[model samples]
Target chain A: MNGKYRILLPVLSLTVLLAAVFYLQPRAMSYFGLNLLFNLAVPIALATIAQMMIIMVNDIDLSVGTFVSFVACVTATFLNDAPLIGVAILLASILAYAAIGALIHIRQLPAIVVTLGMSFVWGGLAVLLLPSPGGAAPAWIRTVMTVKPPLVPMAVVACILIAGLTHLLIMRSSTGTLLRAVGGNAQAVARSGWSVTKLKAGAYALAGVFGVLAGVCLVGLTTSADANIALRYTLLSIAGVILGGGEFTGGRVSPVGAVLGALTLALAGSFLSFMRLSPDWQIGAQGAILILVLAVRLIFSRRGRKWKGAENG
Target chain B: MNTKAKLLGAAALVAVTLPGHAVADTADKRIALSNNYAGNSWRQAMLESWAKVGDKAVEDGVVAAADAFTTSENQATEQAAQIQNMILQGYDAIVVNAASPTALNGAIKEACDAGITVVSFDGIVTEPCAWRIAVDFKEMGRQQVEYLAGRLPDGGNLLEIRGLAGVFVDDEIHAGIEEGVAEFPKFKIVGSVHGDWAQDVAQKAVAGVLPSLPEISGVVTQGGDGYGAAQAIKAAGRDMPIIVMGNRQDEMKWWAEARDENGYETLSLSIAPGVGTLALWVAQQVLDGAEVPKDLTVPFLKVTQDTLDETLAATPEGSVANVEYSQEDAKSVIAAAK
Candidate 1:
């Protein structure tokens, strides 16, 4: 399959979705309207990227949502009240993620089970940190998140920067190639004098960094954190990665695609609510759209592979 | 047949509570407050109120010890386990804000069989053996909508900011709003969104729909979303409509300021966080051999421009709108319930 085509497909679909929403509510095309619609997309995109990093190493992070939520709880409580302890805790949590990666590599355990177990642990810890949701986010963080730039929505600018930076790190760097190779063919990468476990651990650490950022951004927007605030992100992040041309195996992912996918889903909710559809059907509608996008991606990728095969033949 | 069973059930509960009644004069009685979910300010306020009242009771020799347990997961099974542990610890009474209406019935019945008094509030349980203390959230919703209906006499577009979807309180309140709207021919609900009972979420939701909605004359919101709705309206640079304020301190402040500045007249109502204190008093009463009723209905606190200043002054910083009730007031509520 053509590399450019893979990127174009999801981007094109996102454009179409955005256009439809803009057409339905013309006022949504404005900067303020878009800001309102995409205000919550930054954290979701970060979480999706975090999940994408795990997928890049052929491991799924079931705990990303809870981990992000835990970070949010920390951000609202200790981060606001006691900066030194909060920073230490945040750094420690990242280290813990790295350790989880090492543990999975050492034990040869399924990543799903380990992360699922960790989700409970992270959730419990978050509850302990902030039993109820009343804490405030740091003033600077809130200001950064709520800032409205001159032309485009602040969320769009943030997404562009996130995708650009992640793209450079994961798609353009040497370590990125090795990380993908670790998932693609670990034995071959190992035989080539690279430590597969180290690369995998690096991917998990990167995932942790993104998860922390996601939590911080979420707290900035929410101004308060509850243990279950981002519980839905577990599935949403997975869906965003898949919708953004990420695969379950072989460590295939696109940072730009993932951000666009997050934006698409966030806008879908706003679009539906703007249309005043019944809340009961809104969730079903979101599912239908997600399935439709995935199905289209499946068909396109399959056809692209067939065309490539024909050319090779 | 159902009526007869209910009567027998009531008699059985009375018989069960009678033992505690007999032992009311005991020097010390341990009480545990078990909450299913402690993820919101309301729950926090309830717990704080319990601590305040419970500590006073402890000092007064009304309770030997007062302990609070909460499940962060909001899981019914977790709450049930907590209740079981409370019973095992030989608590004289267990006050619960149930996670589920029916999930704790069996555990409550177990506590009941073990001669423990169970009092469930807010998200109450269905176990006939347990006493329920709560406000009519549905009626509150109805009244909010009715007030908006009165404002929009000719029937205008109303943006409805609902509470968390699939929640029992949300469902009841939504149903009541629907019923209230049915009574008012002029009221039209043009747009509805789930605020999840949070200010930020509510503001975002209202902002999203405001672009597509034709001029909304009023916004009917469940408590916690009222101030957010107003903020969304203000942010949109649209004319402020009749927004019913919630019980939040921020809402009271906004209401007072808006009224003083522009004479903005809107009704605000909320199930006070002090209800937990009422439950505490009721627990003390029950343990004191007062024969408290099996069920008690607390009224929602209403705030108008006239009452906004007082409400704001009464509520502490960062707290929700509330009404303080004394032990005598709780006794009156108990008597009224009977």
Candidate 2:
């Protein structure tokens, strides 16, 4: 019946199971396995948190996925022919994505609506940039992301640090409180003399920054940029947000929880692929798992709330 | 009695398809051709050929109609559903490049039970009912390795990049290599692994494996993704003269030409898909009662940077078939080898 118990139990269960499985399957410790986990886990988690950031502000950024896709495609093309241009491409892309969020804010439209339309625009733009997935990621960047550089996948560590910072900010700031208040009751937040629209726009822009980081990580792991990849990652990222104690109506999404959910999905995907399931069934099974997980979550939430109500009475 | 009756009926109709002209034609027969959607140029070409021949037959007053549905993407389930749909629509004949060889077995069998003449192309059928018209994948693979061994007389190191693991094609290709290398004991197979048919995946696999075997002298690959292998070689800090071999993807052809013109040591024994195209043509003739070889291979090209000029000079500039093998009405399988 504990509200906290509902959230903490799954985390505990997953941790224990993963520990046992990792011990049982030491191949999970192999270089390939580690690279695979490091590849999907970081980006998927970053995208999930980015999405949840917007949701926490009572808005959604459907464009995060496609925006990342475009960034990935652009980064690949720019980096391929000119390896030295990596940093500039990344910074410019991040700023552009953030600017897009600012535009959505200034326009005063729903974040969901604007981002949904922008998703297609970004994907189309990705096609315009890279007609196909080709070329190699810069050796220096690839070494940092895929190889065991001075600190392997410094990007993964950066994301976790960002998550901690986001947590700290939510706990310590008035802006974070305003975001929550808007999510729970927009009109009430408006009465408090805060611009709900501006806060929401800022939340979306922050989310875009997270998506940009994820795109950078992908650029490192993959040699080429593909326009079609994010088409699947979009919904899967949303699923990660929901699984992280975030309501679609929007409230209290834990960044840590988002990362954990992403890791779990990544591991599951690695398991499916390593086990050698046919590719056709792999996608179907992933989709079905998403549906089933969400359905189970809904059932657990309903039951937990009912038990709490009974206990209080 | 009914089973015997059906077999007798099928056997009696040696001249199938359409009636008339010098070639056989029912001129009124109907055929249902189903293909997995043309997601890429390679697949699109397959479907175009299917439609071109079918349309010609229809226009020539041979077949009453050629009913066809191209599945979206490479989805096997969609293709199975497509075949079942074609069966329900009751076309006289069906041709399939099944999405999954095994996944489509039961459904393909069901199509056969429905009295549809079935021919499978590219990929084989899971069920054992249809007439299997296929390119000699094993021969193609073996042939490439033989060419590679000849070029790399010393054969210090050769890396083999495999296609979708466990597919019939992969096995055939691998087996062909094994068969080809059985004699050349000096030419060591440096390393081999699967690339899963994606350029990025191939690149990563190559990247991972390349560091371990930096002394690799040559590379072999499946269709289209040889660029990844070549990229991996450069990434590994080795400019080892590599003999890269693969087929398909319009880009690979241009890559081959450029590699040739640049005088790179790469040899694109790109199996001009010329052989498979001819296999289908012979199958179509057999379906139409025209006598033809039971098994045949049209031709394959092993063009290199050295031969690029010669190959190009043979064809008219700016033509589709430029810098390639001469396409001809092949009657039987030939050496197609140097």
Candidate 3:
């Protein structure tokens, strides 16, 4: 319930996971090992931040996964071969996301239904862009992603920057307060003379921007792209936001928490694979860890409420 | 509910085919293809191959019409629905690349009862009445492993990039790899990860486990991820091991370039997308009342260093290399089927 514990929970969890990974594979402590372990985290963390932005507005984008894939498709194919056309398409797609936000607001439609429909559209467009799963990522993006900083891995640095910048923008700024107010009490915020539509649209546009970054980083890491490349991101991002002390429709989220949540999940997978477990058990084990974390959070929240009740008594 | 629809659909099929039966019996057969999914280049290549061969068959008067329908949904129910529609269209034969091994059995059986010749290939069904055409994937895996073992005869660390987890093909190929690896006592598997037979996924997985693994001497993978695995190794700045390639165009291109520059010798082999054409061939033979076996096993095609250039030349820029069988080749395969 305390402000410090709010941040400490996810941070501590990430630390424990990293410690375990290092323990299991001691080599993971090295720069190269850490690089390998966390190389894919940049995109995942970016996706988590993107989803966090949507959740802050009490809306979910079911299409973020496919949208990221679509961006990657464009990045690998058109961006590599024909820059102007690819950049144009990417900008158009982002603007479309903003328009979608406006459409949802003006029409008073359910975000889930709209986003679910858009998922297919995005997936289809990605398939159309790159029918096959072969294309080279632009060289500059690859170099930036693969850069080895002195102490920490580039992935860790990217995660820190994403978390820090988003935290400052969304958690420390007045505009972010307005965005959260739109989710927490839209009518109240509207009565106070701000355009709720603009705030919500802003959130979606930011989500789209982060989604594009996620896609670019992913293609950079993988050196190729496919329509189904980041398809799992939708669910993973939702899970990351929730795991990082976020609430649905409550407008309560933390950027640091979201990034750490993504890192935790990503590390959990690497840990399992590093242990050489069978593929069947690995998926099940991931589910089990998620359930365990959620259960612990539930127990802690209930205990916090009970402690408050005792004080009131 | 399904039975009633099947009856009505069968009735409609009979009503539609009654007039055409007289002409089709003497002239040419009408064939329809029901594909389960079209998300990947492999499926696209298969469909294209089907179209090419089907058009040729039509021109050659082997059949009156050849039609292909693909479902975007990977679910078997969706594919079954497509097959039902095809049955109502009164096609004389249905060739299928099934989604699940058993999910489409009911729909396929209904087509069979309607006197439609059903042939399933690649992701084949277990229904006993239909003809199943497929290359031995287990042999494909074994042969790939054997080839790798020969390259590293002194025994070395191998990293295995597996296909999709829980898939029948993934399990079959993996089992064969295990069997082959068992024979070569010196070869050691250092690490194994499921790539889901996808490039991006395989690259991420291989990158993740690379640091913890022993120095990998060779990499083994299913198709669709060979180039990805190679990229991961190259990025790690490790020596490029002898990677057993899946017959992807990118892999072939990479191998050809590598051979040209460094004299690196590596072979590429896979389950060709031309299996679709083979399925068409079997359907044609059966439509012509040839004695085609209920189950026929086609051998996997192997492309060595000598043949990589030609295969790459034939493959389109961003597709897998496919081995299309000629009409004569199909007839011989049918004649030799046990």
Candidate 4:
């Protein structure tokens, strides 16, 4: 419910996670351990924070997966020292994403419908841009991804910088507070003298910015970006948001939680692969973990409601 | 929407035109070889060779052309759609590198039934109706293991990193390896792993099994992904003298001639590029109404440092090995056959 209690959740969780990591040791350190976990955290952290930004305005932007994947592929293929063209493309793609958000808000379409349609369009355009996966990312740009400087992964640094910047922006501006208010009660916020549509679009623009960052992370981790990469993360990012307690209805899903979820999944994969357990079981187990975590939350919420009601009476 | 539909609709119209053209004159027609997608270098070489051969066809009007339909990869459904479009566009014959060979049966049959010939290369379709062009992958595996066993004649352990599982390539290679190893008593396979033909995953798969595979005399893998196995072996500082990969003639030439700057001796041989080429020829021949036998096995070269030949250096890029035919030679062969 509060800081210490929230800290306990991850702290206790990491202990169990670390214990399992040691248990699975053939070399006493698995590929999915701290370093890899931190790497996994980078993309999920950026994306979840981005998603949370949109959610804070009670709007959803489903095209972020497409955004990141498209940006990564384009960056790999087109983000060159042409200097002028690269800047234009980056600005264009961001504006395109923001424009999609604005249109949906203006039309008053359900975020689910508009964003879902936007995903198909964004993904279609990505495929059209780079039909195959031959292109290479710029050497200097990709250099940030492949190495760990000063014992910290480039991904970890990227993640921390993104998180810190996001924190600073939202904390410094009234826009962040307005967005949260809109999420809690859109009608009330609009009545209280704010342009709800603009606020909602700003939230989505933040998601777009985060999507661009995720694309950068992708280029670093996987030196190549293809059409297939974007398709997989569509659902994975959503899962990250929900798993990190980022409400679909617009609430804070801690960036840390999203990173942890990604790390846990990657570690689970590494563990199963190490054991020579067939990948089938690995997939089934991951799905089961998701369902189990959600079910536990569902049960706890019911109990929480009952306890609160009893105390109030 | 109307403009887009009209353009696509017109393209579709032309694709269906091949069948009618074929009916009027099968003896000499502009034959188009329409294919789904060129996703990899293997398929790239396959298609490029087909196009070159088509260009070199003897009869002036009886030309061969290759029309690449889509750039998308691994989308079987899109691939099937392309096939249907080819049929409608009236390509007199098709050389299919099916995404899922089995899933392609219905469409392949539709084209064949309409008198537009269809033959599959690279990926063998489930349909028995279409001829499979390529090497006996089974024999290639056998040959691979046999070569390794001969090198380590006293019989030693092997770490086998396989390709994408469940596909035709893996299945045939696995079967061939098993068959070949059965004959060699000294050969004991230590570990078999799947890397899904992904370089990084294969590298890790090799790393994971390396420590336990101390007795390993050789490492064998699906050729394209073999670099991954080789990288892992090098990183581990294990000098397992035998390593094999997919045979691109150009690369094989490099391997045979490669002077090591990093100080590891280069032991290289040409695997078989001929398999995919042979498959292409078989498809060509069958579509041309030539009676091919039940199946054919494209040959493999087992070169060591001892057998390194400068003859390989003379072999031209994009030219098929042992295809000695010139324009006149092709005409003579066709005339004699006729």
Candidate 5:
């Protein structure tokens, strides 16, 4: 598959889904309707980007969901009441992620096992921080998320900004090249006078930053936080990355595609609701849409490979 | 019929004489609570109720140990594994708030086969081997509409806010609402959305559908979603409707303020979070050799315009209105069931 056009698949999938939603409920084409349908997409896109960062370094973060929930808990409670302490704790948590990355590199540990264990740690901390799910999001964040822009909704604007900035930081930067090189060929990159450990740690820290943003955005939309608020994001973010033309172990990721994937997934839920399917099949219908998109991506990638083979022959 | 009556008579006799003797019989038995999720305020309150009642029972020598365990994720398979662990740990009895009504049957059968007493409540199991203290969720749903029908005799459109989809409770409540709508044909249901039994989720769902919906005269909700619906409706610049509330403190508080401001009136109802303790005492009773019915029903807690203030005062801020059942309360409930 050509790297240049890898992003087309996610874009095509998103466009088709959006068209279906707008067609079924024509009211969704308007500004108010679009905002209502995609209001929650900002946080989801941010989380996907966070997951993409870790994937770019050839590591998976099983703890992203609970880690995000932990961040939301902190943002709603301490960040609302004591801004300095909340900022301090958030920074410390990012440092903790960096340390985990270094430890994994130094000790030759599996990323999956460490992140899986950390999921529980983060979940427990969140539960302790807000046992009953009754903390308000900081006032400023609520205002920022709910602000009415001129044409596009805040959700759409935030998504574009996130995708554009992350693309620059990741796909168009030297540090990103170093990070991918570490994932692609750690020994070769090490021989080139680079610290592989530092690169991995930096990637993880960047992921942590995006994860915090995701949490904050989510709470801003919800107006409160719960310990289990973002527990589904771990799988959702992974799915978004895969849907956006990311490989499992090759450090192959596309930032623009990931944001589009997140938007597609969020819109799919609204699509199902608008269809008014029986409640029994609503959840199953969501699974079917996910599978349908992935199957399309699969067919396209296969065709791309076959075309490449024919050209070479 | 004769045999059934005979069994009932024998159960009543046992109940009359077993209170004092049952304590001694169950003193050495250890019990475990297998809860599936604790991510919400209702669940947090439920767990607190269990600890309070279970610890008191232990100190009073009703049982040797009563420990609680909860799964991190609300998945049936994980909860099944937890139940198996309880069986291996040799708990004499297990009281559970199950994740699924049927998915946990296999693990529950194993416990029954191991001669362990099982009592399921709230999110009750369907396994015949286990005893169930089930809520009449359908009746709870029906009564919400029944109240609306009474309040507004000239029927109008209702917006039904359901709980998590594909769960037994959600389906039962929905069926009840449908039944209510059928019985009162003048009252129509124009829209419905699954709130997943959380305020934030409910608010989002209601807001999404409100744009496309007709003016709703009443909102029929499965608990934990009334306030969210109110907020969404208010935001949409619509007239306030009578929204049936789940007994969350926030909802009750909102109801109180609305009443003070504009003389708002509505009904609030839910199963008390402390129903876990009732299941606990039932397990202890079963282990004490009392002949108990396979199925039992617990009444849903309801708050009317008259009782709102008193209930609000009793419920802690950010928690559900709750009532922890004592041993005597459990005995009476069991007696009533028999």
Candidate 6:
């Protein structure tokens, strides 16, 4: 496969999905229609980016979903009533993520086991904070999430901003290169006198930052928080990363592609709803669409490899 | 009039007094509640009601212990595992609010095979061995349409806000609404959307679909979506339609405000969260060797226009209106089922 063209896969898939959605529901072409269609995309994109950061270091954070829910609960409850304490707690959570990363590196612990355990911790905290799904989102966050810009919807604008900023941070910067190197060949990087522990910890801290943003944006859009609100996001984020040309073990990831993959996923749900599929088959249909997209990507990559082989021959 | 006749009379007397004495037999039995999810206000209220009633029952010596355990994830496999744990813990009876109607049947059957009384409610299992305490969700949906038909005699276009798709409750209620429309030929369903039984999701769905829908005369909903429909319709600057509500406190509060402002009228109905307690007592009764039928029906809670204020006052803010059933109520329900 052509390394330079890898990012096009997510963009192509996203464009195809957008076209299908607009074709099926012409009303969705309008600004209001587009807003409603993609209103929930921002948080998903942020979560995907967060997952991408963890994947970049060849470590998965299984607790990303519940951690996001925890942040959302805090954002809606303490953040709404007592802003200072909420901010402090959020900062402490980020530090905690960094500490976990350091601990994993120091003790040679399995990332999956540690994170799987942490998921329950975060989930329990969220439930304790808000036993029920009733907490007011801070007024400013709600306004910002619902704000209408000039032409495109806020969802689109947010997606673009997230893509661009994450791309710069993860793909275009020296620090990001070091982070990826830590995943790619930690021994080599460590032999060169670069502190692998700090880089891995930094990667986790960055993920925590994105996870917080995802939760805040989610609560802003939903206007309330629930302990189970973003539980689906764990799988969704992993899917988005993979759909966006990310590998499981490699440090290879695309921030822009991850954002587009999230957008595509969000649009896929709307497209199915617009198609008016039978309720019995709706969830199955969603799985089918995912399979179809991944299959297409597989075919494209295989064809690319063939072309490259022919050129080498 | 001899000794044989006198012995028959004494046996009749014992039988007549057995209702009150049966409670003593179940005093040593332990019951466990295996709930699938507690993420929403409705579920939170349900758990609270179980605690309130279960604690009292334990104190009154009706049961040895009534412990409640909820799975973190609302998955059938997780809940099935929880049920298996309860079985291993030696619970005499298991009360289940299952995640799936059929997925937990295996676990439920295992409990029954182990000689444990299994009473399933709300999200009831389909296992014949387990006693089911189910609300007629179909009737709940039909009643909403009936209320609308009464309000708008000349039925116009109606929008349907449904619960989570792929759920049995959603399908049953949708079928009932379809049946209601068929019965009232004048009424036509113009638009339908899945609300996932959450206010925010419903609000988003309604807002999205409202752009293309015609002027609706009424909105029929499953529980927990009335306020969302109202918000969406209001935001679109449409004339207020008669939207039947699920017995959510926010919905009732909004209805009350609308009524005070413009005399808005609608119907609200849902199964009380306290149905958990009813299932609890039913489990105890079965453990006490009461001949409880295999299936029992729980009455859905309804709030009419006249009773809206009263219901709203009784419901805590952000919670659903509920009724906690006493042991006597459970006995009556069992008798009614028989």
For model 3, the chain A TM-score is 0.96
Provide the overall lDDT of each model, using Cα atoms, as 2-decimal numbers. Answer: 0.80, 0.61, 0.81, 0.59, 0.85, 0.85
Lowest-scoring 10 consecutive residues by lDDT in candidate 1 chain A?
Answer: A271-280
Model 6: per-residue Cα lDDT over A1-313, one tens digit each: 4556678888888898889877876766777666656666788899999999999998998998899989988998999999999999999999999988989898989999999999999999998998755576898997899788999989889999999998888778999899988888999999999998999899999999999999998778656676877787888799899888887776888998899888887777666545645434655876787888889888888899898899899
Candidate with better lDDT, 2 vs 4: 2
Where's the lowest-lDDT run of ten residues in candidate 3 chain A?
A: A273-282
Model 1 residue A105 CA deviation (Å) reads 1.0
User: lDDT tens string, model 2, B14-98?
Assistant: 5453243324454555676666655555554545555565666577765677654654336443355456545544466776666
Candidate 1 root-mean-square deviation in Å:
24.3
Model 6 ranges off by over 4 Å: B1-338
Residue A139 CA displacement from its true place in model 4, Å: 2.3
Model 3 - which docking category? incorrect
Mind giving the per-residue lDDT tens digits that candidate 2 earns over A53-139? 777866677877787777777666776666467567666665665666567666866777888898988899887876644444556
Q: In candidate 1, list every pair of residues with a backbone clash.
A: B155-B186, B247-B321
Q: How accurate is candidate 5 locally (lDDT)?
A: 0.85
Worst ten in a row by lDDT for model 5 chain A = A273-282
Residue lDDT tens for model 5, A77-181: 999999999999999999998988898898989999999999999999998998755577798997898789998978688888988998888888998778877
Tell me, what's the RMSD of every candidate?
Answer: 24.3, 20.2, 24.5, 24.2, 23.8, 23.8
Candidate 1 lDDT for residue A156? 82
In candidate 4, residue B98 scores what lDDT? 64
Interface RMSD for each of the candidates: 17.4, 15.2, 18.5, 17.3, 17.0, 16.7
Q: Which 10-residue window of candidate 5 chain B scores lowest in summed lDDT?
A: B72-81
* Residue-wise C-alpha lDDT for candidate 3, range B206-242, written one tens digit per residue: 9999999988887878888888898888899999888
Encode model 1's per-residue lDDT on A1-313: one tens digit a residue.
4467568767877888888777776766777556645657788899999999899888899999899989988998889999899899999998888888888987899999999999999999988987645576888887898787888879889999999999998889998888888878888998999877777788888899999999988777656666776776888899888888888888778888888888887766655544545434656888888988878877887899998899899
DockQ of 3: 0.01
